[model samples]
Target: MQIRPFELERYFARHEFSAKYLLGSSDPEAMSIADLLAFEPGSEEELKRVWLGYTESLGDPALRRDIAGLYESVAPEEILVFTGAEEPIFAFMHAVLEPGDHLVVHFPGYQSHYSVAQSRGIEVSHWHGNPNRNWAPDLVELPELIRSKTRAILICTPHNPTGYLFDRSSWQQVIEIARERDLYLFCDEVYRGTEHDPADQLPHLADHYEKGISLNCLSKNCGLAGLRTGWIATKDRDIYNRLATFKDYLTICNCAPGEYLAGIAVRNMPQIFEQQRVRLVSNLNLLAEFFARHTDLFSWQRPRAGTVTFPRYLGGSALEFCDWLVAETGIMLIPGTFFDMPGEYLRFGYGRASFADALARLDAYLAG
Candidate 1:
């Protein structure tokens, strides 16, 4: 199947490694292997004994059990593991959608949400978020976007870039709309555990809706991007089977060592999430102060969750500003154009240990 080049990944390929400070990364600060293994006693010894062989295609049983623990109603048998969140997304596009199918997706989101479907000749309608409302999409507009051929509604809560999480009422409204239309509800919950306020955390969609598919991974909230382990949890047996079958054409099984390590991370997620939450909250505070001081150069809205935030750049085109900023300062900020959003907006990530230093450098550059 022919597909357009992934704009965000392509941009990252050009600069992610070379940039001195990554101020546009979406994942939190990652821990070393030693730091992660330290969470479980004797895990270091267990890692040494992991067999270097093909693993269970559905996923390691123990790891699936640990992942199932994240949801209230989903079972290990219902979860399908993949190399990363990307695989399941690709699989769903090929396995469930057809050339004439229609999909409604949350706008200004990860490219794969729509790009893969588009490649297969599917129609995609964007459900956009409002900047004035802290990026929350209006529920009333949802039903209007659905067509007779619509098959599913895809969303990213505790969203990427904007960090706009849905409140319980709004989330329920989305579920209701999908249910009324008998449509599949696909939620990209990669940033599920990063709510700044624990009280604002929403339940896993699979647990609450029979047709809901919750796509998650170790990359964002768990700060274990190196593990490259992710999964889809769904109570719909048919959907689970379809995704599992399509995965065989991709990476049939996960990295055995990555699965074992993921099991460790999942088992001790409370502590791991706490570590990331603490760092994220600290960086967010600094960002608040930085944006407040530079209101003349940008417009800001504090995000409800996730590692990144979209701010409007008052200084000319955001693309040009990002290009100039990275070239002149070696600190990288992603332009909104990569997310299919162009003009004045740019994405700033505050999930790294170097956020303070990077912000300071930008501040100094502005002052000069």
Candidate 2:
């Protein structure tokens, strides 16, 4: 299948390692394998003992059980593991959606949410969020975006870049809309556990709606991107089976050691989430101060959750500014152009422990 170039991933490939400071990454600070195994006293030996043979395509049973516990009503049998969140998305695009089918997606989102489908000749409509309203999409516009061919509504909560977490009421409205149209709901919940306020967290869409497919990964919330573990949770057995079958064409099974490590991470999520939350909150405070100081150069709104925030650059073109900033100071920030967004917006990430240091460098650059 022909697909458009993945602008964001390609950009990261070029600079993610060489850049001195990454102010646009979405994952929280990662922990070492030793630190992860420390969560359970005997896990290190267990990890060492992990069989290097092929793992179950449905994922390690224990890992599925642990993932099941994250949802309120989903079972381990309903979970289909993938190499990462990207594979499941690709699976859904090929396995479920058809050429004539239509999809409605949250705007300024991860490109794959719509790109793969677009490549397959599916129609896509963006449900754009209002930046003036702290990036919240108007619920009223949602119903109107649906058409008879619309097969699904895709969204991200504790969203990437903008950090827009839906209030429970708005969250329900989205599910209800999908329910009314008998359309599937796909939620990119990779950032689910990183809410700035725990109360603001919404229920896993799969638990609340029968047609919902909730996608999650260890990369974002657990800061375990290297593990490359992600899964889909859905109550619908048919959908689960379809995704599982499609997996045969992809990474048939996940990495054996990665699954073992993922199991350890999932079993110990409470502490892991707490660790990320503490760091996120601390970095957010520093970001607020930095933004306050640079009001002349940026239009900012503190996001409710997630690792990154999109702010408007008062400087000429966001792309130009980011290019100049990175070249001059070795600090990397993503321009909104990468998200298919126009105007002067740029994504700023505050998930890393080095965020303060990065912000300091940007501040110093501005001063000089």
lDDT of 2 at 155: 96
Give lDDT tens digits, candidate 1, residues 1-368. 68989999999888866688899999899989999889888999999999999999999999999999888888999888899899999999999889999999999899999999999999999999998888999999999999999999999999987999999999999999999999999999999999998889999999999999999999999888999999999999899988988888999999999999999999998888888899999999999999999999999999989999999999899999998889888989999999999999999999999899999999899889
Clashing pairs in 1: none
Window of ten residues with lowest summed lDDT in model 2: 10-19
Runs of candidate 2 with Cα error greater than 4 angstroms are: 16-18
Model 1 / residue 234 / CA error / Å: 0.3
Clash count in backbone of candidate 1: 0
TM-score of each: 0.99, 0.98
| lDDT for each candidate structure | 0.93, 0.92
Task: Candidate 1: list runs displaced more than 4 Å.
Answer: none
